[model samples]
Target chain A: MCGIVGLLVKKPELREQLGALMVPMLVEMAARGPESAGMAVFTAALPEGQRKYSLHAPVWDYDWGGFEGEFIKRFGPEAQLGVQGNHAILTCDEPADAVKPWVRGHFPMLHILAAGRVMDIYKDTGHPASVAERYRFGSFSGTHLVGHTRMATESAVTPDRAHPFTAGEDFCLVHNGTISNPYMIRRKLEHRGIVFETDNDTEAACRYLEWRMREGDNLETALGKGFEELDGFYTFLIGTQNKLALVRDAFACKPAVVAETDDYVAIASEFRSLAHLPGVDQAKLFEPMPEEIYSWTV
Target chain B: MDGVNATDRRRVFDLSTARVRDLNQFLHHELPGSGVEQVEVQHPGGRHAIAVGINHPVNVEVKGHGGYYLAGMNKLASVTVHGNVGWGVAENMMSGTVRVKGFASESAGATGHGGTLIIEGDASLRCGISMKGIDIVVGGDIGNYSAFMAQAGHLLVCGDAGHALGDSLYEAVIYVRGRIKSLGADAQEEEMTDADRAKVAELLARAGFGYQPSEFKRVASAKKLYHWNADANQEY
Candidate 1:
């Protein structure tokens, strides 16, 4: 089993407390998932033509200053990197298409967790609370975020296999159930020249949906296709540029509860995580129906 | 059953300071002769297995949202949760009444044997799966595949039901006041008689719902898939 937690602040002021409010929710679900924890936070977008590339190194004290100096030497003083624990957000005026290939060509050891104008990803294999502390999750400020705690049923327990798997820019998915036909989906995507990052089941699903979106289907239509093609028990909580969407499989094979108030909307695998939220007693609490997509925008 | 100095008839359990295990230990081990007829639990914080496995007659009120298995294996105890609950609330309950003032997650009263489980708000999927002799009343719509393979019981939903209301039923009966998306295999709707109406009325009254009995429809097993048939080739 795994735990999926998402929060989208309706009030702009609550965005500052997004990570603080979500850490408790994530920690409460450690009972459901204790193997690994990860999240994708959607911060304020950089100006047009700029992007943030989230990079993770194997060591906690990697020399980010040296890496930034090298990047500036190649691309001038336009690239700036902010280091946080083992994770760093490298902001550059270059688009993703330009920066990704260059980073991959130069630094083979650094894992690019995500690249987008607004989203920053941090994930590691550890207890959710400790991982949160390792990444300073309490001080994160964002309009919305999607987090996951994995029990690692189908894949190995590694930081790269941890959830909030991303596809295109600003899109990530965290899953709470296993997919039955991931190999089939993987074959379909790989046959189309789409590369997969890992053998994890959630990666297949994330790549599938994003492939559909790249091919012209919007999020809802791609999710409609996901309901048709993806065969298995899944309660997928997805994060986009400005939205948080949740969808359960047709069988309701996994559990998900949603609590929405005027201030924010919180989605978790169980209500146990949501009980600590502010104004939750008065919030409108309900479960999303099977196969229906519940989306909330920032 | 050691030295507790509670002289009041109503004892309160503050979950903020007291662990759920200790609170349950008090309800399980020392409450019979403790002279505390009512126990109120505060700050439940959505914890699991609160006030479970009670064998004596008592009143337990949970002040806020409870987690999974709020009152499982209950007997002769009336437990009320004033807020929402997580999965499997009052599962495998044998007797007495367990009520939730707010909504419940999946499998609300699964495999219950006796007593009444009432939800004033909606219940999620599989509300009363494999029930035996228990009664369930949902004030709002129930989710998909409710009452699946129920052996013997009465499930009353005052609101709409999602897909496959009763799948692979046995002797249990289902009375739905609102729309049923579909019925499961071998489960068919039958004409509601006066006795069925009276049964609905009694349960509704016991659960304090104001719905009229005439608004319901009955669903029971058709017994088609009861035995092995060699000629059918496994098509229902």
Candidate 2:
């Protein structure tokens, strides 16, 4: 089992409190998933001609400053770098496809968590509260955020196996239940030239969406198609650049509650995660129907 | 002066500080006829088993949602959830009432032997599977495979029912006001006789649902599988 939480701020005034509002929710999810935690925050859009890439290393002191100099030497001096906890964010004028290969060839130890204009992914293997504190999540300001506390069902406990697994450039997915046929799906996806990092079922599902989207299917279409193709019990919270989508299996064995208000829309594995949100009591609350796709945009 | 004292001052437990175990412990420890008649539970969403295994006739009012097994093995207590509930809200409940003002997740009243479980909103899959003698009244629709293998009980749905309304049912009576997508093994629709209507009316009134008894369609076992026949072996 795992716990998934997402917040989409419809009111601009509440955007600054996204992380602050999400911490308590994530902490409450500790009972469901205590192995590791991960989060992805979509901040304000980047400036024109710039893109951001979030990378992580195993240790806190991983020579991020030196890596920045090396990146500038290779990708030109127009790159800006900032390090938070074990993650390093690089904003550059170069496209991700061009920069990724160069970084991969040069720094094989670095793992790219997300590459997009608005999304920055932070994750680690620890208690949810400790991971949130390490990244200082309470001070973050963003239009939307999605987080996960993993119980390590099918994957290792390494930070790389933590969730909010990235799909395409700006897409990420967090899952609550195990997929029974991940290996079968993985083989099919591999035949279509989709590379996989871990043998985790969530990664397979995430890659399936990315593959479907790449083949001209929209997010909703991809999710609808996923419901037919993916077998097993699962509740997924998917994050795109500007949209957050939720989907559950037909049986809906996993728990999910959604609350929508004038200011924000939130979803969690249980209501406790949503109890502390502003205007929670007055917010409209309901469980998502089985096999239905519910999406929200900022 | 009234006999109410400080110990019976309507105990209030906040889930933020005291866990669900604390509340369940309080309810279990309270003996019959204890002065603690009313208990209010605040911040109820994240916890599980909030008032399980109770024997006293107290009232528990939870302020918000609840996790799995909210009132499992309940007896005599009247527990009310102002919000939704997770899986098996009142599993194996012997006697008492478990009410949810909002929705309930899968198996809302699984294997409950007796008591009343009321859901003001919809209930997910298998709402009353294996129920022995409990009475479940849902104000909204219920998901698929409800009342599967139920030996005895009464299930009342005010709204539509998903596919396979009652599979492998025995003795249990089902009443639905809205559409039943399909019926499961050994389950078939039956006539709502005068006695059945009276029973339905009594249950609806007990749950505060004002629907007329004539609107409901009754479902009961077909009684075909009780004694197996050699000719039916091929079908099996």
Candidate 3:
């Protein structure tokens, strides 16, 4: 079993300072999932004249600093890559679809996890500090972030098999627990021409959410739809650039503790993992209700 | 039982010799490592995981209290813990004897594939859930939901039973001797005939309890929930 920690601050003040404050809580939760760790921050960035889209590329345990050079080499110098906590934030000069094929062709393992006004997803193998150091994560700014510490069971320890797996633009997911029906779900998704990048239950979970999102559903509704169809134990904390959502399976087999005060809303697999958060009173802890979907945004 | 130490000639240790925690750990590591046949742990402090995962055919005598999961999954060894055990004592055990001289916690022998778990005291709720061929004999009152979904076994509770006893039991014979609060879904009270009385008497004797066989009540499943009907539109 792995651990997942996610925080969605309703106010901008807490959201801007999330990365610095959440580092210790993520650090304490290393034991629940010791194999790998990752975090993503989704902060809305203002643009002029047109829709400002940020390409949320989940760099699968690749060279973070060299991603800019690698992207330029693959898609020519016109494509620019910015850094955001191990993920390469791409702002293309044109619409991202023309370069999506080239990007996929260049980095076969690279997954276009999310894309929107402020889509950000960063995930990798190893300790959070190691993944943080390779990408200079501490300085990357964002408002809301969802994190993961993975203890791999079904898939290999590659970056593609990591959490926060995405499907198309504006769809990102962080998950815990196993999916018992991946093979059946995979075949259905493949028939629909949805390309799956990894052989992970997490990917299936992402595809389930994405398939629901494609059906004109929002994040909370999509996750609620997932709960109805997906079998097995799971507690998912999913986020787009703006909306944050949480969903647990019917049985509540996997553990998830949620706490909310006047200041912030925090959640992890255990109360011990939330020790570093400000004003985490033990009495405030709560287990996520089974088959319930919770979401909040500013 | 000095005869156990003299003729059995197992490793003997008093409270002054070593702590029960160290003694059990030593016996678990060294008995299997050194091929020692039998061992004893005296004056336990309700600590957990004593004699866990012991594969060899050794006889372990644990004296005093214990916490959770005592003698869990003992493959060939016989562990006689001479005190009350905490929750999930002997949980998921396979092929061994766990005899508790005192009370056992909730879900005692839960999901154990195969074992003979004899408890001299009461057991808590959900005891023997999904039990597969594990024979449980409790000498005292059993809490609610006993023998829940027991696949195959004989659960002999010699005292009063709590509410929701034997809920959703499957292919398991439950013989309770005292008053029952309520029977759970899919489970029904059956007639305690001469044959069931004999079986209960034999099980009580095995657990070192001397009780009249006719004083017990037999509970079993009605087998209604075994098959599913897709088209019948039955709510239950």
How displaced is residue A53 in candidate 1, in Å? 0.4
TM-score of each: 0.97, 0.95, 0.58
Q: Each model's fnat?
A: 0.72, 0.67, 0.00
> Which model scores highest in TM-score?
1
Give residue A269's error in model 3 in angstroms.
1.4
**Which stretches of candidate 2 lie above 4 Å from their native place?**
B1-9, B224-236
**Candidate 1 C-alpha error for residue A201, in Å:** 0.5
Per-residue lDDT of A244 in model 3: 71
Better structure of 1 and 3 per lDDT: 1
- Descending-lDDT candidate ranking: 1, 2, 3
Worst 10 residues of 3 chain B by lDDT: B1-10
- When summed lDDT is taken over every stretch of 10 residues in candidate 2 chain A, the lowest stretch is A192-201
What value does DockQ give for candidate 3? 0.04
Question: Relative to the true structure, how large is the alpha-carbon lDDT of every model?
Answer: 0.92, 0.90, 0.73
Better DockQ candidate (1, 3): 1
The regions of model 1 sitting more than 4 angstroms off are: B1-7
Regions of model 3 farther than 4 Å from truth: A46-80, A83-87, A106-113, A136-140, B1-166, B169-236
Residue A123 lDDT (model 2): 92
Looking at model 2, residue A91 earns an lDDT score of 94
Residues A43-64 of candidate 3: C-alpha lDDT, one tens digit per residue: 6663532222333345445675
Better of 1 and 2 by lDDT: 1
Model 3, retained fraction of real contacts? 0.00
